[model samples]
Target: MGRSPAADAEFMMRDTTSHPPAYAPAYKTSVLRSPKNALISLQHSLSEVTAPVFRADELGPLDNDLIKNCAKDGLPVGERLLVHGHVRDQLGRPVKNALVEVWQANASGRYRHKKDQYIGALDPNFGGCGRVLTDENGYYFYRTIKPGPYPWRNRVNEWRPAHIHYAISGHGWVQRLITQMYFEGDPLIATCPILRSVPSEEQIRGLIALQDTSAFVQLDSRAYRFDIVLRGQRATLFENHVQGTPQ
Candidate 1:
């Protein structure tokens, strides 16, 4: 027999303690951004929960191929990488047709934004952004150059680890998640203040993507698998919520 609504709801309940506190002082910027008052929960209106449907045709044929989409003169200079993953709900059911967006600095650690005055030279061919929609089995993949680590002003000599930023939206506004995925075996992961802000070692580990040798393309690109659990005890650490979303 299928599960009842109450049982489904129970499976979706978030473990608040599993996530980092919004006021992590070590993270510095979170100080002023954290909530100043007690929070209130509200029920979602039908319009808020169900609008904004994303169609497959709305995406360009090269939308998911960062390596070629922005190429103008030549291919971007960096190690080729294939990042693939599956998105699942709290109950382990696939989240089909979910939209996954990614943006990152170039292999030299410089972003394409004008405000980014990092000394690293930007590759003319690398625009550093891409998007893809998950299949019926919640699988999605993208090709890009492995990003480089860069220094930040958070501390005197602090540097951010090489990582990719992700924004995933499931059916509607309420089913959205924003997180970062770090590569495995990066020594910087142990010391980066932003990653350290996570409450537990296990939760911090969840944000790291494992190298998937099995998926590596011969003489082409290395692959990394970063599955996303959308809710419950194993939810990926999302920047948008302290208490996880029901969706």
Candidate 2:
């Protein structure tokens, strides 16, 4: 029989050794500020607990479509976007059955969160969050709008680039990764301090999804492909985990 609900919760809460390392040293900005700081010493240790495995029955068909829920009245206001990609492990093997979650600001540069002080009008049709599981080939896709840039107090007159936030969890909880996906050809990409913070240009380049004109429809929306490799081929075991977006 499957593990009881309470038992599964306990397993997820416990630490496991099978998972990758906790935080990456290169992402010091995120590490320093994260709650994990309290346990920095143990961040690199193998875990004794593992993330709970998700049952196929628990996920629904509409979960992967961000726009479907809000389209009851009509399609949300914005250019329709189709983002698709593959998830792979260090050895270039597909990490199937993974859960991927995404959220972003609406096209007007405003988020639904109450704390978002951006003055742009909010769209009643957009909820701005979605989730999907990887297929047998470790591929996932979603439909969303092209989010707009938003101003923040990080610096004087600073505005973030158009991007979507992503949270990925492979078979194990310890394999979880949180990062942001940026659009190609956006001028803001060069100036974004968060992106520049990454030490290697190659790694930074991986974060930007390139535009695919072949997928574009006349008078319709464009397409972007962003393939994610969970860990690089030469990367030390668990050395690179999450590259969380700086909120």
Candidate 3:
């Protein structure tokens, strides 16, 4: 068996603090204005965006600090979840040691905290958080429960669909990325905030909408499938933006 990542990076790690690369561009106002026409002609969207999938990975042994320090950082410590993604550099070459992080709303679309009353308190057993460091093959995994829909203060009190937020970092943040993974068949998807926030059609290029299944999860529970594309991946195109928004 391979040694743990903690030991693997101990000797090689220099400065662990990092600022990942920015998230992909925002959708064009015209495209985001309407959900019906947004996904039309999304041929090479991922190529234009940085991080594009949402996998429910359980927290690895290393995320204890994130778990104990804050409630906003709650992540399920142990559970099987659906994850998604592909491994390829911008030139189509595979990546090595890609890192992925995820944060999402609880079963009620509310965060785990004392103020979030729209939903109940967090499940003592579940933390709604996780992380995964890809292998040489550029793959990752996480175990988490399904996220619930929540209200967003959009357009006079609008709500976003059930979704999860994510970030990808490696080499202490060489080409890090942040984005969100969406669930399939969500009613609120019709008015997704991240999708609606964009006011540019061209910006709304890489929004994965139920195409590839291999990246999806195969499990017994109602787990969702999701995958992510780091800043550089062969075959896929992108619109490099160094900043990412909360999904």
The lDDT of each candidate is 0.84, 0.73, 0.50
* Candidate 2 pairs with clashing backbones: 15-48, 15-49, 16-47, 16-48, 16-49, 17-47
In model 1, the number of clashes is 0
TM-score of 2: 0.75
After superposition, the stretches of candidate 1 with alpha carbons farther than 4 Å from their true spots are 1-13, 232-247
**What is the lDDT for 86 in model 3?**
53
Q: Can you write out model 2's per-residue Cα lDDT over 1-247, one digit (the tens) per residue?
A: 2222222221122233323234544434455664564453333222322445565688777777777756667778888888998999766889787888899999999998998888977888898998888899999888899999987766677778999999987654446788999999889888776776665677778899999888776787688998876642222224354223222
Against the true structure, whose lDDT is highest?
Answer: 1
The predicted structure with the larger lDDT, 1 or 3, is 1
lDDT of 1 by residue, 1-247 (tens): 1212221132234457767888989989999999989777665544334435578999999999999999998999999999999998876878888889999999999999999999999999999999999999999999999999999999889999999999998754555689999999999999999888888999999999999999999999999999997753223445765345554
* Candidates 2 and 3 compared by TM-score, better number: 2
At residue 129, give the lDDT of candidate 2: 91
Question: What clash pairs does model 1 have?
Answer: none
Can you tell me which runs of candidate 3 are displaced by over 4 Å?
A: 1-80, 171-174, 198-219, 233-247
**In candidate 2, where is summed lDDT lowest over 10 consecutive residues?**
2-11
| All candidates: CA RMSD (Å) | 7.5, 9.3, 13.6
